[model samples]
Target: MTSLVAGALLAAPGVAVAADAGAPPQPLVGDLSTWGSPCAAGEGRPFVRAVPNLTARLYGAGDHQPGEASRVSGEFEAWWLDGDGSEERLTFATGMRSDSTPFSWQLPAEIPADTVISWRVRAVDGEVASPWSTEGEGAPCEFVLDRTAPGKPVVTSADYPDNNNWTDGAGVYGTFHVDSPTDDVVSYVYDFQGGPLLRATPSGPEGSADLRYLPPAGGVFMLHVQAQDRAGNLSSPTYYTFRVASGRAPAAHWSLADAAGSRTAAATAGAAARAGIGASFGSPAPSGTALTSTATLDGTGHGFLTPDASVVGAGKTFAAGGWVRPSAVDSVRTIASQDGFGAPEFALGLRQEDGGPVWSFAVNGTRMTGGLPEAGEWAHVLGAYDAETGRARLYVNGRAVGEEEAVTPVAAEGNFQIGRSHGASGYRDRWKGEIGDVRVHDRVVAPAEITRLGSRAAQLRGHWALENAPEGISAEAGGGEPLKLAAGASIFRAGDECDLLDPDCIPGDWPLADEGHLSLDGTAGYAATDKPVVDTDDSFTVSATVRLADNEPAHPMTALSQGGVHGDAFKVRYTPATQSWELVMSHADAPGAAETVVARVEWPDGGQGGGHRLAVVYDDATDRVRLFVDGHADAGGTAEFHDAWESDGGLQVGRGRTADGWGEYLRGAVDQVRVFSGVVPDQDIAGLM
Candidate 1:
């Protein structure tokens, strides 16, 4: 394992963070935990779990002497007040120094479940003891301890059988019954699709939960269930196994191409998922499709909700895909997902990893990346659970980007969602983008069908209207073409603008948009795409907002580089020895020297890599590479270097590769890392910063 050696580094100076002057007061006993985590591991009902040492506080303000408040004589005691106007003293924690704000106690283990009683505190100083703190403190605050676990729950399914016969097919909505062994059981814990455990609250007084589960595809499935009582105690788990024959039409569908703000949601083929209170509609979608609009979720708590979770559950084959346009890529955002009350079954979304925004399909929260998409650009994305192969697959623009042998997926038991997921903290990971034409299938869609879905959506190339291009993908944007970023958002351009109105717009020159970037770990970490950014023999431009994890590094590092044979054709790196940012080009594939251009400006005043924009431009005709700092070329002649050469290697972020293997890892973070095919004008490059 790589050590977090950077943890020993000091935080860089120059960044200001406001201190939180106001925060909640900590409990007197810092280790006193009230959450019911241990209950899950406790013995089933009728058996109580052991309680650990607990603590309490007594106010002795009235007992303290005026001048000597730090210490006092006598003892302090605590009591539990019953509802019947009677009190039973809590048997412990009796220290009597005025300085002792909270007294502690080691109560007997195995407190009876459903025990609820009020509490009081008293202190005595020598012979003059203070009155109990029950009068003015209003009704005594309740102290309830429940260590008993609930009885094991009973789980049954009617739609699929575990007899090993492949009968039921995919996309079938099935019902599950979770019955508690005890009446007080309030909820049930269940596992689906080898993902996280989920919760289903009992809607009836008899302690039962009726759940609707959708088999997304074909596979052998095992469902695990457990009961939870009101005291937050859990019972032993119950398990069930079932199987479904693969290949069937989807039972539910959601095409998010509804009108703007249309709360009356509808599905083109299956059950409809209702729009939320903050529903936004009629956003732009991809071209070349019958649909022209999409639903935009703002990433707060807004999304479409399907009351019944007729999606896929544990061990079921499933496939979901859609067109998405994100508004931001700096954080986690879910476009399509479903889950129960506790853990998530799956989510198709965006996350920042490896120093860039990537498209990932998660199975039980384990993300498999598809590719990278620029914010404000359009892309088709999909996730699949291949039961036959026992694998998880992800695709971007119809091309497989990532695949892995499947881990057990936890099944979802609550609801199907568009643009968000549910957890203990309510809805989270909401999508801050436009998502539509989402289809969930019972079987893993074949590659040809996946490709067909994307091709018909739109064929627009290169830059798009903020549809968000995934990073590190051999993605469809640029249609494998090349160009330069012209604005803050991605606008793929050659020189200035492509105007169809001028009747001179070239098919290959149509305007495409992208202002996305990639990230890198300064360690031995790096990212590579399938194609090179551009031929180094030709003019090209690249820029990124960069920040280093370590303010001061032990050695030099590269933010970006491309290779062909023995050496990098070009590299953008920070040389610690020179304390400068340099752009390098190799003179030969062998052990030859390189032509270098350095930025002459002092490092930005902000500490570490405080998001400084660095741009490298190579004008092949001029045989020179120009370096710009924060959008402007430093006045020093060192900013430009002659004798540039072409490196045909694919674009790599975070590290460079040499004849010696990969080295020069970037220890910092970078954003808005854009690569264009042609050199943009000085004014255009300046506008990016």
Candidate 2:
């Protein structure tokens, strides 16, 4: 058994932020109409004031009689009137204090907890006194001062195992018992392993919460629960430790559930093995309410397990898998390894060679490469090596990237280590990333099995259903080619107003349109089609569903365009000036000049809206270019080109031309794009719409 050493807890900077209070209060004179004389009502409140802690003050001025000077010659008096008609008076000088001018007073000690105190103010100068200024008729200003908090909540019920440990696959439910002597408990705040604070309002004074960490990845999570009274006083926190086993036990596994730890225990079946941590650790993955979590490792540090037969000795036919989100890849970032540095054994990580990061999997010191994942994104990676077939394969998010032959088995002297490579000499090649659920198996895992356990990222025909994730990809997806995101490109949640344009209109399924849309910010926002879609002669149909955002500086925005302004190239654009939808086709008319034929249709609804179907058809047989809206043709015109338009440039979406000089980048939702080699007949096009 390896000694378990607890690492120091180093709080991550800015991991959590307190909620922001709105703008500061602006001062104003109080209305004295309701009070009938002396004092005037002020801005801010008749507000609630918490006693013995936080407080609210009503500010106002003394109203002078008709014959008196505007400035009353007396002190402002504030009355703290109880609901039962009892009152106490407090006084403060007018305007000499913090610019709020009116009388301010603390809740009197006689005021009980959770009691409401109504108030009114009057001005008194010697024998002269003004009538009280009330908030409403017989309704004085009211404030509540709460000085007490709810009792500490008890962990009434926890569904952890007998030993307070758990494995994946089971659900977790915990109920907190809260009681307040002075006020009703209003809400509960839960913090799991210091990741993020989750708040839940109780139906009444008590409630049960599904305390399970989201995504259900393996790890140790410390649970802290606190109850808040209606008065806003939070109870002392109650804490408990929960150990979640990996969803599935591998030959050996390290869930890395302990956020601040130098030692992590293996969750493999009936195993008590542990690994020693090196250097400082980082906060756990900030995946609030997410289904999964990870631990961060500094590039200069790593964790290593001694020669564990059940894990590293899983032999030649084995599988290693985990989730890694890298911060940078300038140097090699090790995910998991049992092999020596550059020596025979087994290892899976990322290495930058040829100037870009690539998946690096090795068997017997022969390194094989796989496709790289975008930086700062979670990628489920699996490396399977089969000794019998001498085949080694690497997969990212369920998609197979690369495979190689002549793979060897694990070295006999290999000691399993994570975030670092260890050879006969020592450990090197540290990692800098968030890694979670490290699992090693004794059998070569199949691609189907790996895909089943990964995230969903479906790709097809240069179109990706990003919201469904890469896992939802079918065999025929991606046009047999993968989509590569341009540098700095990303997928963001479409605004609430985005049009889904769901073709089937599946009930309750608005689809990915508004959930995950390709985001283009005009500058450096574009994606490369894994494969090129070239125009077939001068006859082709371009179709796309789009929602044009009212982005100012509307100049002209292109949804889809091909190559340059010359040769069978085409562009779909919304012209702000003309309020029309235009399809521009440019063809070489002469050696140095190109003739452009444009088919323009007054946009539906005068082009003042979004979520419209746009398509352009060019047919050589009819010698006409036509535009379609929804399904029917909107406009058509005759145009004869010098020759069949053609260009070698791949089709561009969200922008026209290449990154070197992109034009009219779209600022809206673009989805369901298709390019047919030949002009699609009206019937076929209608069916598609």
Candidate 3:
């Protein structure tokens, strides 16, 4: 047997191979022939070719065509090269048995775009090395990396149902569309100036996002939409602007008909014109026309001027007048006028008679006896004169009361005053009774005008009910809408209730009024111990016309409590020790953790007992909590916990907790207690005062 000497041969500095003489001489296992770029379609196969030594047997040979050999334990390796021949390994295999053996590898995720890879296969035996197969250059297969993202989302449509002018409290409908040509867009984020308004996701090929929103009560708002791709790329944001109006009014309904009308009008005046009347003008005017003629009168009150411009003619010496009936003959007077009776420009005169039992009229500052009737009853009177004619006449219920020679020409100013006079100064001053149908004529008003005024006066003698009430009171009359009882008086204890009359009826007791004042006896002690009591399910506003006494309590005391059961409650209170009024809010869900001190009030003198009006408004829209003292905003704050405090607890006006338990009653005179579901702005409060 020939001795087989085996020795280790160094292939490279870090690699070695064993060669045995008896095993057979090794073949050169270098110089792979297949490499270069694959086909454009990336589907072509690669193979290796090299000069083969047929004399050497491959040890890892198998039945497969690229024939495997036992000596080859690992995979055959292949790679592509740049034009410069810098090689990159594409794949690996164990062994290659034949000269025509092939090798293949799939593209990797990290491969660069447009790369050209080439590959080859090699075979090796225990001591003999088989040669590499021929190398194949693949057709250039261009690699593509995803570089696309979704484009900016756009607001395809936006609409405000009411006012269409983007005014306050209007309903908003916004539509968003996104286009992503290359990648799939998955989600979108919408941002609103007031808060996060909505979020949307793509539904299908032509999907859209929609939102119905209402603006906040006091400011302008903005909405934005942003789209994101599946790969986390975001599109630019799209923005829109809308306005919020001041008061509480329902959003107007929208219809295709209305839109068509607007389009028609716009088309006639160029679709770009923004302010002109729309085609929808054919529809009945949304808000009816202003007064035009007395024929439209309901006969319950004064009618509009008779459109005869001559009645309110240009340059005439005619004096016009009518009759009046005072609803309540109190010391203070009520009047009607061309300028809002709240403030007027012209005037008729009504004063107590000598007997103090009757009411008479003074026309243009001329006092006439036996011409005007009494107060608290329909009275007839007339003022007629043509200064140019030097004739003045006064009539009572169609009969002449007094007459005077023309002295001053009747003022020819366009404005006329009915219940009261215009200008800061006027001879007749203001009328103290409800005046009826007033008429003016370029010529002297005939006796027929006086007769017609008297007839109209007969029908205008009744009272109307108040719809919106303030805070803790309820009112009722003989027949009409129930008068709302507002807390317009001082805060009292559990025993003290409210008194609509006597302004000084507030005591340290809770008061309840159905028709009149419900006063606390002040002599007794009544307090609420547990949670504050409030009219459940019923909404209210708190108002007080109060005159604080010198001996009022100095500690913290509630002015109004707005919760009934063991749930959420809101309190408007005054702390004399701190010289401030505070609004405290608490919810049962949070236990003793109250979200209190929403607002506060600081008085310069540390007290507001000398007669002042205080009000607190709770509105659900903005969930605004506001306090007003003396017709001004004392404090204001907001919170958003809806339906958290809806329980059935009758309202408690002047004390803390309930009137049954712990007594922390108020001390002072209380008047009107009003409540409303809607928010009342400062302007309305000032008007009421």
lDDT of each: 0.60, 0.54, 0.40
TM-score to true structure, per model: 0.35, 0.35, 0.27
- Candidate 3 lDDT score at position 665: 53
Error of 1 at 302 (Å): 41
Per-residue alpha-carbon lDDT of model 2 for 1-689, expressed as tens digits? Answer: 11112221111243221111321121123332112222222332322224432122332134222332333222333344445555544443333333233334443455454444444444433233333343124334444556666777755434453246463422223333433333366677887678779887665433433443431345675668887765567888888665665444467766665546656554644354455555233445423113245677667644443335436553456778777778878777778777544553677888887888887887777777877554565677788776656678877765677656575566565567677776566676776777776777765555556766554321113334434224322111444444445643455554334445755443321322436555456555555453456543435677767666563435677777775443326767777777667776665422344545465555533213446777777754334677776776643533444344556666766766423356677765555666665456676765543
Consecutive 10-residue window with the lowest summed lDDT within model 2: 1-10
Candidate 3 lDDT, 1-689, residue by residue in tens: 11112221112232223333332122223322223423223433232121111121223433223343233422333344445555455443334333343333333454432343332333444444333333233222222222344687755433432223545342222333434443456677777674755677767566445554534243566777777654355677777665555433211111111232343212111122121121112221111112121111111222212111122332344445443445444332323222322333223444456544333333334444443233434444455555444456656555565445444333443343333334444312333433333444334444553444343211111121222234632332234223232333322333335453667766443222222233332223222213223232223355644433333455455655656444336666667776666666665433344455665555522223334566666543234566777776732533343333554443444555532443445554444545443345557775543
> Per-residue alpha-carbon lDDT of model 1 for 224-333, expressed as tens digits?
88888766678888877888766565546666777776785587667777777766888886655566788877777655555455577567778888888788899888
- Model 1 poorest ten-residue lDDT run: 1-10
Clashes found in each candidate (C-alpha, N, C closer than 3 A): 46, 29, 99
lDDT of 1: 0.60
Candidate 3 displacement at residue 98 in angstroms: 99
